[model samples]
Target: MQIDVDPQEDPQNAPDVNYVVENPTLDLEQYAASYSGLMRIERLQFIADHCPPLRVEALKMALSFVQRTFNVDVYEEIHRKLSEATRDLQSAPDAIPESGVEPPPLDTAWVEATRKKALLKLEKLDTDLKNYKGNSIKESIRRGHDDLGDHYLDCGDLSNALKCYSRARDYCTSAKHVINMCLNVIKVSVYLQNWSHVLSYVSKAESTPEIAERGERDSQTQAILTKLKCAAGLAELAARKYKQAAKCFLLASFDHCDFPELLSPSNVAVYGGLCALATFDRQELQRNVISSSSFKLFLELEPQVRDIIFKFYESKYASCLKMLDEMKDNLLLDMYLAPHVRTLYTQIRNRALIQYFSPYVSADMRRMATAFNTTVAALEDELTQLILEGLINARIDSHSKILYARDVDQRSTTFEKSLLMGKEFQRRAKAMILRAAVLRNQIHVKVRGGGTGAGAAQLGTHTWAHGLVSIAVPSPGREPGGADAGQQPVPDEHQHVRVPAGPSRRICTPYPQLPALLEEPLGSRPRPPAWTPV
Candidate 1:
């Protein structure tokens, strides 16, 4: 029998969800002002939800800004949240005296008026789109669709805005129009929290010939590229691909990063910095983050994040992590960065720990703990985990409180590898010799009787003895293995002479008959070549 357990209920399988921000040192007015449109209201609402200290202030800002748009539903929702937060503040033990100010009453008249206005505008846009379609003008029809999308977006109908924006794609007549349609769709997709759709449209916008061929030379194209990169970075961040997200954000052009509708320049710096620190190695951090000319402008926007990256690169782990901790509250208040804060922090800490012990043969657990600002037991646990994961080639002595790098026997390893290579060479050489012998002998299985049965098969061999005999035979006047000045007597033509075949054997044959044997075949039977040894 198997018991099914919920992953969320299993501590080991569950993700870290302790994302809360308290006491953020953010200037709400300045931060909110950096963004416009739905982005500002949404970011404020998110900050209000996660941060208790700034709940009422954030909600009040969102409530006020939301009124400028025709999103009556969101206005009511923000007001409701503001009222709750105000009541909670009043009931707190350290509550201040009432300042004689209350949240503004629900604007029913404005709500009704805005709803009617939105409906009228939507209908008018629909009518215009139909008229454009009837006229069969592609550009006008595309503009009509975009106008409808804008109207839907203003009224906080993300679904309808997305549909309208996507509909414009079919009517696009040029690369610029297609890019515009894709950007509109991407914006709505982001607002809808549809990250995959955002990434898809980002890719489409980037792949357009106007953007791809023009590169970054054109100011207008550069701005669009920056927006595309930032959107892709957010999608990658949401997907938990920290390295890819870092690369995307780092590619964004600082001067052209004016997409306040999505994120601020300061956000690019923070997101790119933390991601680079978490995933990039020392050389990559130095070469890409510290020395990058384009991204330096972005880094200048967030000095704190810039300092954290420098500190981490300089091997100042304790101070760097401390700064990160101090900034956690503010980062958690961010809508995009909040969910990944804990995971990124953990990865950065782990990378630091791994780098700390990399250059040392052995290190004391106490010193490492102090460097990481953690307890000795915790440090030991982390080291053990790294060792198990093969990130660190080291071992620990529990009683001694020391971690030692494992010794590798290079000489034995080298000898073993050489032996294996030698064996392989010998095997290959033997195979080559066998193959050459088969080809030299012309040996093969010959099939007879035109039959497929094994009984009809016979071995056939062709001797290459004629060429060997011709090369081995010397001139008749000169004796084999004898100097020209030798005084040895020559045997008579009819007499049998003993010729040395080798050191251990001799053959008796008439001197004149030996030359005749070399010119004739020996009875069509396979035999060894006649020996004439030196």
Candidate 2:
């Protein structure tokens, strides 16, 4: 097949060809210097215009001589020009013969041959850096490898691209260059889903002292590390190392929070799965439960994770409730609830009941009614005892007043009046206690029977438990001047009382004057004075 050459289609043969190459090399050194200066000024068009016709081999040789004898200035200039020229040619249309032009085949072959020759010359220059010695030469070699790797990467040859990058990274000496190489390796490993390799490279990158000393690690690096950690956790989960997996997943979830981008649905699902695994493993829970310190640390690290975790438990609340109901001895509650009583109560009241109570009641209201009846009966008995004690105290006071009033002449009238007031107060107190007990029982019955429902009764119970813990548990340490070292302090005690080392001497102090009583009767008859002590 004969290929026709078209003069109009040939970029090199265009009218601008003369404008592109008008300068010849008379003083090679001076010309190279002048050309480098033009390039430094970013006047690429001038250099292109002055350079000779496409003498590919000669141009490369001149560039090498300029690099060796003069400076990199000329070499960089030539590379810049050549790159621009190549881009321009690529943008131009392929050479085609015009109608009736009938160009010769050799001419067309010569054009393709010339372009290939130029590319080969540049390729050789790129490769020759490998033969040079020293770190400076190695840097050039690294650049060449990087350029080649980019070419391969752009061409979709990931394996070859990785190989080139790996070679370049081996020669990297600067911290910046090393970090770049590590990042490149990480990118490829991630693309390939080589999780183990990704972790290894990340570990190496992070272990570098220079990288460690950096005030802030790069976000991309942190994100990659977070993802690898999560993947490692998933692998452990797959291997049935549930405890280890939970630890890893928890760490990953916490770390991922640093970069909000990692909190995708996939990661959430992974976190949820780890939590589910932990729930199934009783040994893991037992090991973690006693160490309040560890639980605190977990809370600090993953505040959001607890909600998902509790939700997981909420799904299993029915099972826990069933266990509680079936075991009359409260053994199951002791096992699961006592260690985490405060948290369990809150979860039951806030989350578990809110989500499951309706379904539970719908399934069987009779069971709830029975439970409520038992609780109400116990509360009623306690209230009855309290009322009876109050009545007995009031009766004793009344009897004492009557005996004193009969023996003393009009002097015991104040005592009689005080006793009567005490009886009234006791009566009111008993009624209030009875009313509270009755109301509690009614609420319990309503909650259990699914009649007029006690909305959020479970929540109220949880709040009550929280309040009990808050009120009953003593603050961590004792205050000064309040309690003796050997004595246990009361829960509400805020200060300690200190006794001095001196002999026992009572200190007499006057009480503050009380305000005038506005509610007292104005015309009440006065009682005679009782016998005064001498």
Candidate 3:
């Protein structure tokens, strides 16, 4: 019996030891040139770990670069890897003699010197921070902490760097201080591959009052926002949320994309383009990717990715998929994109298949296979999966090799929809008619109490004469002597006033300026009340 154990994944560090890259078309020199600091060193190390052909060269570049910083440990580590890689190359049967292939001798003196300088600098920063705290100067304390974090980061101590950066939070005096602190923490977190921390700080920085309320015309704010978006994109990509990652990358302003420590303009194009291709529908791809003015600038940095997106949108599945495959090797070399390449490609292919059959009620599997650049059997299997997943409302005939859309009773559906619409229209029409009647009658109702007087006695009195109805309101401070004086007061709640069934007449209510008459129910008319001028 064989037992297979899944590799334990560490939340802090994810090592893809089992994954290897045999062929990569990356121009190592040009790619390294696009980044700086720890970003350049880390990317080169990642390439060395994954691709054998480029291992020695990548390690050599990393070694050369690491010496420029105070990171003595990483320098020695890269040197060790370089030694192993060089030996492996030399032992190869097809190995050719090369002079520079051998690893460089370790610089013990420089390492010792750098460590001493680093320690001395750390002591000075700590002393300065303590002095700032003693003096109670917030800005000085904040800068002191940031300086320490920067030194720690330079020494390749990401944990200490993150801690120092986070510690600066307590000394932050304003929105700017908080944003700067967050950016520092976010940068170190990205280097540490702490994606959740990166996202959390990105949100914090963005929510800062200065960043959130910043005007678009502010160039500095736009640049900062671009950095935030790019960092957020990397985190979302690592989390396997292709759509959200695409949105984040797409939102980055080309003119403001200057985060060389993490990504380049070309990276933005590739990451956003591929993720959008895999996740965006035809309309979204066209509207957000192809038609975007800002993203167009990014796409110009990588014409191949831009072309793939255009071809996909134009419904040229064969050309698009072929282009995607051609670039697969280069994409696999990207540290952030490598793990998701296969998944993204599969999604893009499936989306293409779905789009190809969208407008057709039935399609011939043979032609579909040719269009998709796949065999009939493969196409049938794909269609089967899509059918089972409910992505396509269709049925497959195995013998005929035909995919047919399921029949739907459009007539019944249309009839049902029309009936619902008609009912809604009837309801609206009734409401409108009621409103019109109320408006035409000029109804004015209020919940005020009927105060004591002739007004109180006459309140809510409805009198009908010649099919006309008039509402009489009691006049204040007047005795009730009308024929309906004995009528009881209406309840405090709303009173339902009814309209006569006969032909409509102009609705008359008591007005202050007009002389209103009081009447009895026995066909008797009382004297008109005196009019009071306002």
Candidate 4:
């Protein structure tokens, strides 16, 4: 803004390296040239040697541009190869001044100060990236953190690595990078033996579109998914979730050219086949586990795995257990698999018991011992355990030395079901009654008034031959011969009757004794209580 030294007279000053970074007025075209082509590399070397603070900032700014200019893989290669070459220039003397104004020597104390200042600059970069509202810079920072996470992972510091990877994933703007970060997290989680977290990470990785769908089509991705699935299966097996373990192993793709680092084909077979043998029912074992395509692929990896499973499915119970016992040496040696050996064998034993008892209603414990190649007492103990687990619906006759399956009462079950239905119906009926009462109150009913009286008459259309006649007539509300303001009936065979529907109303039908009744005049001796209507 003011009169400054002329460009021709003043030193070139390392090609405008002294320009104000905050509000520079230098021609952007000239400054841009210094960061371009061969000049860019030279300037980077110069800055790294001379300005440590600016070097970190420049690495933060320029590395991503290089990564974009080439690619991630190439950037990684260049970073690995050329980083030290550039650092060597830190000790080299500063280049001759562009305008013959020799710059000060590279000061160790000044560089020491700049190196510390670089961290502050990077911290400022962190804050700037937060406030900068752009996806590109955010993704750059994510990738930066990803590299740091990878370093921590290599150092076996999973706690800090997980922290970095988690932040990297959250800052990701693209699905590709997000999936990469997820896989990183899963890797650390597995190494840490955080089995529960491994399952969750595997689930997330499997559901990701880039991973799950392409798992089979892409060899690398498929291998990774296979490993993940295998890890999850092992976790399940460790937890004694044999059925879930079988499903996970059965879903894995093991035929790809790429193989997992931890799980071998044999490992897959043993874990998958044993889990299947333990949890699968007869039909499921044949259709989904032993004969399924995935299991078949696993079989090719290790035929013995399938053989053991097929033996169990065919009811060769003793053979299956014997095979597992013989192969214990090799199987128990696997690092990924050795942990689950006991539980797997226990499951095999339980399956053997289940298959052995399939056809028996009341098998003697001695015969069971013969079939299983064990003592009668051992067989009895196994049966008791099975019964207690609710796996077998039977009771042991300790005295008779026989095991009897409890006969299920279908009638009792049906009766209980019917009772439940009736209770539900009763509750619904009461609700309907209340609803009906509410509706009834909402409508008005009109009734006609009675003049003489409200009368109810019964019409008789049938007459039996030689049948004695019985007639019903309305009675006075007040009891006759009792203390009341009512008249008593004359002494005759006629008796009073009451009809609930027609209280205080006349019947209107003639009396059955009409012709023979009224033989004496009512007004003579009795005078009809002096108020009777004649």
Candidate 5:
């Protein structure tokens, strides 16, 4: 039988051919039709394990082999074993048995040359299609470019595949074509690990408005959108943007994405539920993840994520985090999450804290530490971060070892208002006292300057309860002025304590003979400080 070999596969290194059994003249019908397919699986698995670049191609070949051999007239035992081997190969390539046989190693230089040639050929095809003038040819040309993109993608050449798909989109006239192009771009970007590009393309396609409305009516459109959203969710999850990832996953339709081969049904449940738990409050988790309609479908695929979330919902936070920790290996090995596994663990810890403390106004540090399976210092650090970011309105009384929640209610508002009021009143009162002293000095200067009977200019006057006593002092060139002996000074209600307006003037005082403040009004009285006895 003629072997159906891939064009890109190099000769001289064909896998598993029994040289002894080769006879050029032998009847082709005597050979097994399935032998080559089975060998292909082994070669792919071995190559994939040895070279990560071949992993995607290996997976696709394995899928095709299963469909062709199993669904047809293949033996049940053989089919089952093949399927199991393929699964193990795909899941744990490194661990697959070599069966005492070695496959040919990949030629890196040849691969590089082949990849370059393929890209050059694709570019030529794109140029030809663009130069062709016929409108009827556009659709066929678009499909050609699209098929080229798919081929490149199967080869793990994502960058070129993305370019081909973008070219295909330019010629798309049908709604179906448009949606497929968008999905293709998203798929290619996902493999490239270009998360921002994936998001950009998804948003642009979704914003078409017709997409949502059409996605509602057309099964194909609906399927594309579902897969698109799921892809975006995975990208967001990989970036540690848990809340956004949760929203995208929750909104995605499950009918189109519950496949074991595509983003596995298990991953959806794990990513969605974990992200929801991380970002949402307890009530939000109940409403959006557990009680949501899409959740019912997603959970059916993988109940583990749902179970972990439920445990958290039940306040078994320690158990939930422990379960996640125990499953760390599984999570870390995930295709989209490998880079962010540690961040995911961090999210789990933070979520646990939020969930455990939601119902309580404040929790004791020691008790919280025990509940979270963490040390007191670490717990304090976490709480401190949460508090500083305003994620939690609480404070730690370091001395008392009490963590108290700040009151955000009306009573607290009133307390704050009272504090502000006291400060404002004190400020205004101090200002008023200073202003009064300055004004009284101005009046004293004016009164003394106008007095012709004065022996000296009075720079200040003290109004007492008995009377207003203006003690005039000698001007700079004159003698000291005294109170009139015949007329006892009467108090002026309009005037208070006065000082000279001139900046050079001073109010002299000898401590023992200081004036008595009995005549001063209580609120306006200037009393010496407690340390300075009158």
Candidate 6:
């Protein structure tokens, strides 16, 4: 069948007309077999021609093909051209018009996609080259293994990651790269909580000097020291070695003092934990008390730090107050009150009286006076209740009568025999009152300077009351040799009869000059009787 074909419609189907033979006809097989190579050369020539304006995507594709299918010569040529093109693109004049040969828009997504594809292709090529007996190929395989190991590590597969990293370290040609790989391996080990490995790596990183010398003295060294200390503390705590843990915590505290920023929640936990552990030891408690007292005194020197600590402790102040109350009841009572309750009460009353008159004492003394007054008031109410209850008791005995007589006698003797002692007690009590007055006066002075007269008048009235009480009390009689008489006769209302002549003479002669009620010395020396109540 004769088919009419249009030459323009199918150019390849047209019969070749032998016009004139060239000097040598090109062989079709040689050309067909070399088509890929020829096409690569042509593509490269086109890129080279366009040079500076070569599209990155097009160049990448062309180079990739050249690398995959072509021989080393072709691949190298393509690589050289690609490098030249990249350089030209990078160095191109900013003012040059890019309108003629539009470069592909560098969308990061597209670039990444292409990179992934290239990597996959490279991986396949690497697998293919694994059996090849060449130094370069072996080196490439080594790098591929290293890269795979790193990938596993980044994905959190520590075991495989470590293996890959170790391989990388072994095969790494550059010292810097090897060092980096080693550090990275150590970091992974730390993350994995491999303490031994961490220690080893830290030691290695330290010995290297480069890593050690890399950070600031205060920042780097202090930070690492803090971590090490914290880690050590945690270890000790885990081991249930409480004393060691406490020591570690103390060291950590010192370290944290150097870097306050490191006083994080974890550090606080460590501190609290250690403190709890240490509190079990009696020696530790004593040490803590001494330290705390010293710290409080030190706060006086550093008011700012003191204020911070105060605020910090203030949050726990209620609890601390409760603890203080318990300790006072338990320890302080046993130590100070149990053996010397009567003496303590007398001393407290005396001190309060003396401080009341001392205007020279500070406001703190006035506060103490107020506290003492409250204590005395409470004690007096308690004693009054006890006495009233005792008087109502149905099972009263002669001993009870004697007890009642002694109580009555104690009160009466204050006005009869021991006028000086009563006056001294009254003076101390007045001193306490006067201390309060002084504090009020200071406050008034602060508020209105010389303007206020009310505080002074109030103070005068308080002092007068104190003096009246002092004069109403009697001087205490000395025993035959001035020794204290045990179980002396109890004097009741009926015992207010006339004193014997010699004793009355002694009582009527004004007692040795008593200390000024308003100006009792801080010393224990007996005051002269000149200031004694009339």
lDDT of 4 by residue, 227-337 (tens): 777778867875668899888888787575233333456567778787787778888888887668766876876666667877777777667677777776445433345
Worst 10 residues of 6 by lDDT: 493-502
Model 4 residue 204 CA deviation (Å) reads 3.0
lDDT of 2: 0.40
At residue 386, candidate 3 shows an lDDT of 88
lDDT string, candidate 1, 1-534, tens digits? 999987636464344455566678999999999999999999999888888888888898898899999999899999999889888888889988867447888889999999999889888989999999999999999999899989889999889889999999999999999999988988888888899998999988988999999998899999999999999999999888999999999999988999999999999999999999999999999889899999999988899898998889889999999999999989888888887887899899989999999999999999989988889999999889988999899999999999999997989999999999999998776555544432332323221223444322111111122221001222334433347423433332112223332222222344544444433443432432233433
Task: List the candidate 3 regions with Cα displacement exceeding 4 Å.
Answer: 1-17, 414-534
Candidate 2, residue 283: CA error in Å? 11
Q: Write the per-residue lDDT of candidate 2 for residues 1-534, one digit (tens) a residue.
A: 999887546453222223333334333333234332212222222333345333332344344443332223345555555555445544558734335222112233434554465456447745664554334676877777777665554333568768887888767878767766766666565445565665577667666665577524666545545554554554443333545555654444333333221222233333433343334333443344322342334454333334434443545544444443332222111111122223233333233323333233122223322333334344234323433654211111222221011133455888898899999998776555534432332212112223332433221221222112110111334322336534544433321112111222111112111011112233331321121121
* Candidate 1 ranges beyond 4 A from true positions: 1-19, 410-534
lDDT of 3 by residue, 355-435 (tens): 999999999999998998999999999889988999998999999999999988999999999999999998776555544
* Tens digits of per-residue lDDT for model 6, 15-66: 2222222122222223223224333334334434432333344455555554
TM-score of 5: 0.55
Per-prediction backbone clash count: 0, 5, 2, 0, 8, 27
Q: After superposition, how far is residue 475 of candidate 4 from its true place, in Å?
A: 38
Q: Each model's TM-score? A: 0.77, 0.28, 0.76, 0.52, 0.55, 0.24
Error of 1 at 326 (Å): 0.7
The digit string of per-residue lDDT tens for model 5 on 1-534 reads: 898869955453333222121112211122122234333343334333333433444444544553433212222323344444455555674765545223223334544565576567667766665655355577888887887786666555668779989988778887667767888888777656788988888887887656867656777667667777787897787566889998888877777664222365556777887778777877898899889887778888666676788898888877888887766644533445545555666767776776566567767888888888888888888988887877777888876666887777988889999999999998777556545543432323344335444422233343323222343322222222334423433333112333343423333334332233322344463432221322
User: With candidate 3 superimposed using the best TM-score fit, by how many Å does residue 199's alpha carbon deviate from the native?
Assistant: 1.9
Full candidate order by lDDT, most accurate first: 3, 1, 5, 4, 2, 6
Q: Whose TM-score is higher: candidate 2's or candidate 3's? A: 3
Candidate 6, superposed: residue stretches over 4 Å from native: 1-150, 164-186, 203-218, 223-534
How close to the true structure is residue 17 of candidate 6, measured as C-alpha lDDT? 29
Considering summed lDDT, which 10 consecutive residues are worst modelled in model 3?
Answer: 514-523
Error of 2 at 174 (Å): 3.1
